[model samples]
Target: MSRIDYSVWDHIEVSDDEDATHPNVNTASLFRWRHQARVERTEAFRKKGAELEEALAESKHELTRAHEKAGELAAGSSKARDDIERLKREEREWEEKVAAHRREEKKTPWNADTLCRGGFSKIAVINDVKTESVGEETETFMSFEKRYEKDVKRFAAMRSWDDSEEYLSDNPHLLCAETFNLLMMMCVDLEVLKKRESLEQTAHQAVVMRFISRLAKALKVDPRACFRRFFSKMKAADQRQLDTFADELECFKEEVRSAAKSPAWKAMDEAQRELEKEEERLEVFESLPEEMQRCFDRKDVRMLQEVIGRMEPAEARAHMKRCVKAGFWVPGAKVDGGDDDGGSDKEEDDA
Candidate 1:
């Protein structure tokens, strides 16, 4: 069994309650019966999941062989078209079978022991590309996206379980990101050819990855590792539970898109600095002694002098110093340091 990371429980909304028993029945026996029933249901779901997987595998194998056989038929052969259609039908049937099992299995509560021992974990951003690794200068997110063309193509062309598994096992680092992108691209490619069945399968894989990455981010876990955890939880989810995950994924994706465009997180410069300075000046202006404030407001030089004279010399000087620096008011409306009322009637201090 995989290690149970209770952290996944952080944001979940599931309840665990003891069984309700009739007054005539022993509560302990009722509880035991409920526990056994849950165990049996979980085991059935696990067996069904395994069977669905096996059936899907067999269906895909048949579809592959059908494609090869169809290619050997003449271009205008109705039999070849018929063969292809049959394989496509089988594929859809298998997909539906797995989905139906997933829906049913979801009603049962999670059995930690039944969780897959395998899956993806983290989301990592390669920070500083060394000369030895990338063989180039460091690249931004946009630059890396531009360089991903061939890598995307190679991933999209994956046709078999062995090839895909081997490729992913070897390039586990890129599986969560590049693999997902390539899957979506493959869906588009298939859609262009009017291959809706194949397109659906490809898109499903892409959605699974996208959801896994989102879940990993929420739990602060690695996307690659959490991918399996997601599957484990999902495997036991009924339709309602599955729909909840789908809805949350859609909302989260929309939130990210909206936030990416807004400038709320970016820094500001000149206007912001000026605003801050003005606020600081206002704070200083409010801190002055009441008598000094009246001197500033009335621009009364004689009254200001009277106020200063009443205080300790150093204290009065410090008050005046703050007033001057904040441009609250100058000592006088005058040319000299001591402006008589006769000097200039008005002086404007520039902040």
Candidate 2:
């Protein structure tokens, strides 16, 4: 069996591992001082490395620009050739400096703080809604409705991005998957209502949420934690970026309209209209005069005739009209003083 070599471990600088010190010396203070000095040294080395890396990047950029300029100029142009050669030399020098920096970094002995770097990959909830873990129930539209439906509606109604950013900044807890789902549903509802302006505004907000969600995914962070970053980027975005965003907003609006035109949405709209009609009919029925209501309830032609006879002509006409609209009275039905051969009694009050 081969013996493991421990020579690599000799360079680890454990500050507090000193086995001996003067009796009067403050050992704790000494250890702390050593740790602080080591940290300062490491930070200085890292800063130097960063500066070298930046220089190298700048040099490479200049070299690339020079090469492009050289290509554009005449083949025999002396100025472009001179610039390219100078930039190439500078780039090589910067690269050498960067290489030296890396070698120096490797030479720096590892300390207790740097021996083994620790890394963490975790998603933390920023608000009251905790992130669901494996085996936990994920947030859904129904659950979102139960919690944030009203808040989401208020957010959707906001016409300005500035106001929306402020709102989300204040209520970071709402920057979740559920809130996104609600916003999308709101867009669909607004589209179904034929609210073009509101639909566009809500669709824009939904698309913003989607972009934030995507950005968070790309950065491997919680959407709630990084939503403000998205807003900041948007606020500073160039015209091209803004135009792309606008395009996405239009596409999202189209999607909402498409959803609203689906068979399921058509059926829902029809059902909603029927319910509204029924409610209106009930309201008209309730508002009718007691005599007319009784006549309809009893299905008595004579009673209706007597009631209409007692009432003023205009009042009787109004009541009968409401009853007809409410489905209490059928059009063309025979009544007292009217022809019995399937004729309407609508003109009976004239007599």
Score every model by TM-score: 0.29, 0.48
Task: Score candidate 1 by lDDT.
Answer: 0.59
Note the residue pairs that clash in candidate 2.
Answer: none
lDDT of 2 by residue, 72-139 (tens): 78898999888888878888888888898887777777778887776754566677867767435443
Task: Estimate every model's Cα lDDT from 0 to 1.
Answer: 0.59, 0.74
**Residue lDDT tens for model 1, 1-351:** 878876544542223653455779898987667668877877787767765665565456556756665676677788878867887897899899989888775554445444444555656689986653342322443354466655655644555434544554555565556556556445544544568666544555466666657666645567765455556556666564376455544443444344434465123234455777899888987888888788768876778767766877667667766776776654444534644543212222211
Query: How does model 2 score by TM-score?
Result: 0.48
**Cα lDDT for residue 87, model 1?**
73
lDDT of 2: 0.74
Best by lDDT: 2
- The C-alpha stretches of model 1 lying farther than 4 A from their native spots are 1-33, 36-101, 106-269, 329-351
